[model samples]
Target: NSKPKDTQQSMCTPVCLGASGMVHVLLREELLLKEHILKTIILGQMLSLFICGTAVTSQYLAEQYQVNTPMFQSFINYSLLLLVYTTMLAFRTGSDSLWQILKQRWWKYIFLGLADVEANYMIVKAYQYTTLTSVQLLDCFGIPVLMALSWFILRARYRLIHFLAVAVCLLGVGTMVGADILAGRQDSEGSDVVIGDVLVLLGASLYAISNVSEEYIVKNLSRVEFLGMVGLFGTIISGLQLAIVEHREIMRIQWNWKIALLFTAFALCMFGLYSFMPVVIKVTSATSVNLGILTADLYSLFFGLFLFFYKFSGLYILSFVIIMVGFILYCSTPTRTAEPTALPQPGSTGLDNAALKLEENDSETPAITVQFTRGEAVVVSTD
Candidate 1:
């Protein structure tokens, strides 16, 4: 009778342990799935803040320290980003040269580099001829262009209400900037405002194109590797432009601790922007990312309370409320499914195996295998 009882207990032990393991795996997967969207949204917000901070600091540096050469500034930013990517690649692939992959993807990244450098240069230069209000107002136009591009180029889907929300956000931006302009924000003697506005428009359009293309590229490729390739090519492109255009200007800029600090700040923020951008793109559409960034001015406004001793006006408050409504309205929509419509070339593997996240339990006694797709991950037990 004692032998029979002992055998019964032994039989139940493995069954109970296996059931517990299965329950743990399912709970972990469910938690991760829920947190993924939250993580993406937070990253998008951080990207906007970084961009706003970068712009503010860059303006300060230019106004205070007389360091306004766009070419040299871009070159330094791209160079530092490239160095970081190079180091990451070296660590990621020990004993394997990066050139093996570089040879196949050079032109793809060169095009991205060109678009990125041009976008940065044009917007920075536009500030010389136009008021900040004009630049900010016109910059919001990129969202519409990005929306159109997403529909045509990337196959992004949206509802009529979503478009309306975007329009409302645009209206808010216009109101905020228009009030500033009416309050004498523009220089009466500035003669090139029209040209500056046009430049800003062109720059915004180019950025829209670049952002759409980038979203498409990252949807089919590794986010980190794509950024690394862009940084490498952008550095090359910027170096050429700097040598051609800003050779003398770069040599003449005053060098001091403040200038050095500003450069470091700009470089760090730019790097952060590039790194997190792909993640946001992966989690949401290019249009969503643009819409999310519509709040950058809002961030700057709040930041100004501390830094610039700014007093929020009625227009600012109204604009902030309107923008918030649009943001919440936009966020209520579900993410669209952007299938791989076209590859850069025939026989490209980028379209295949997109959502397979690997989970390996190498630290445990018996390893567990998990395969992740869009909705859920399934765990496989190894005996």
Candidate 2:
């Protein structure tokens, strides 16, 4: 008597009942993970646009309404974010230690806050003395500073390609800055060029330090935890500084709905920017984040076209496109050297031979083979 037909076939073969389904499931998971990465990058870019645009709009409104106290803006922005996150922390469960973590690592956040404040202050203060040309030129030094810190402090490994990518990015930035200078942009605002240039340079360095600290925190702590800590410190530190420095000036400024709305929008964007930064760091790095932000100047130019009717330089447009190319070149390609998972080689062990036989009886999926080539692991898939 013949057995039931379902029982007659070999269960291990490619045509078995469940083999194709298993492969489909595995492939689906891989696809979903790739999709997640794509989504994150897109979201990060959108958030960046919001951050830069809103910040520019806020500054424009401040100038319009004669709001002279910038530090007050920073104080309110940090305070609002702190309150929001603190509320969130209250509702969330199973979070990392709030106060305890701060006690352990408070200095880092405090320093980050100070660096953030000082960088903004220095750049704003620089405008009182330096030409816009010098400020724009010196600001780019952050990239090199960040990369150096990443290499030395974070122990990041880099290759020649990485250096080339950074060079292309910086070259693109230099082109844009040079175009502004050659275009004979009006500088009716600067007073002491040398002192302001030095301040801008120092500000760029402080910005790099803050960015590195951000990357470090993102790598160690959860996004919520880090944001809460930063907001708490930023509000306290900036509030105290603002009170001492701008107490009289803030009282003189006109408080109106337009100013209030602009301030609210600015605060929201700051919150969004800080919140999304950790996700970007998780997806890529501080270097890539800086690269993405290199486009902010381009966005500012576009916004200026609408508001200020500034003459659009074809050279500036070309430089921006070049920067985009460099950013895409740096990001779209996987920079990490692939660590080939070493598969069992032929004749390495008796079980490896048995495994090959079993593989043949199984699905048509290729067998993974590993070989060492030039001290690097190379993996080959053989059917």
Candidate 3:
């Protein structure tokens, strides 16, 4: 009888130990999730502050310094990226060399580079025609466009909570806009508000494209590759555009230490934005990054109070808080994995299917392949 009791006690001990271990694991996982959320929030705001820095510097250049060279400004940023990231990429050793990557995907990077370059130019140029606040707020237009692109192109699926969070963010934007109207600040510093708003919309759309592409590249490929390719193509494209569009403006600028410092500040801020953005996007979705950076407008307003002598509105504070709440809500939930979708099969010709299978198997090492035909299908296979 004592032996039976001893055996029962031994079994009970193992069960209790197993239960304790499971609880510990669950608690640790919960703590890790909370920590990750906190880190993402901090990183997102840092990016926002970097954006604010760029905006403030751009506005100062356009207003006080009378510098309206958008292409030239972007050119500097891209050149810096090329000088830094491209160089780093050259030294990186892996399955493919730098030349191999460029040879294989040069066209795709060109598209990305063009979109990125123009987006920066348009937003910076809008400062000449619109108030800083307008530029900041209108940029949110990209969020919806980004979501749509992600849904189709990136195969990202959103949850009901994500939609709710987005709604909350847009509501914050509405509150801010209302505040701008109440404060009689809508037309302030804006020469042609309509034109500026239109430019912002166009730029925001382009930004959505660039961001979604970046998200895909960084997640599937390498962050260094994305930055390096963007840098290389971006520098070349921006340089050509700058020569055609802003050469005269660049020549006419009255050079001074103050002006030089502002330009340097802008380039550094932009470089920082580009370098760190991939890290954030890799951890979170492009949509979350865009939403997180919405606070950039408030940061700009805070600076504008001192620099532009803008009037303060309480609604702006409320808007900022609301946006933060929405961002937190969105980040609390993990992004869903890309849902499986039907891939386009080979054409009626058996040759196409045979060739596709061969290519797919060859590229299996990287686990991603881009089909140039059939609407540029991206097939990702994982182990």
lDDT, candidate 3, equals 0.87
Clashes in each model (backbone N, CA, C under 3 Å)? 0, 0, 0
lDDT by residue (294-345, candidate 3, tens digit) is 8887898899999999888999999999998999899888766574555556
Per-model CA lDDT versus the true structure: 0.75, 0.73, 0.87
Residue 25, model 1: Cα distance from true site in angstroms: 19
Worst 10 residues of 2 by lDDT: 349-358
Candidate scoring better on lDDT of 2 and 3: 3
TM-score of 3: 0.84
lDDT of 1 by residue, 183-296 (tens): 455445345999889989988988998898889878876676666777788888888888887899779878888888888887788878887888888877777788777777
**If both were scored by lDDT, which would come out higher, candidate 1 or candidate 2?**
1
TM-score of each: 0.73, 0.75, 0.84
The total of clashing pairs for model 2 equals 0
Error of 3 at 179 (Å): 2.4
Regions of candidate 2 where Cα sits further than 4 Å from its true position = 1-44, 87-95, 333-383
What's the best-to-worst order under TM-score? 3, 2, 1
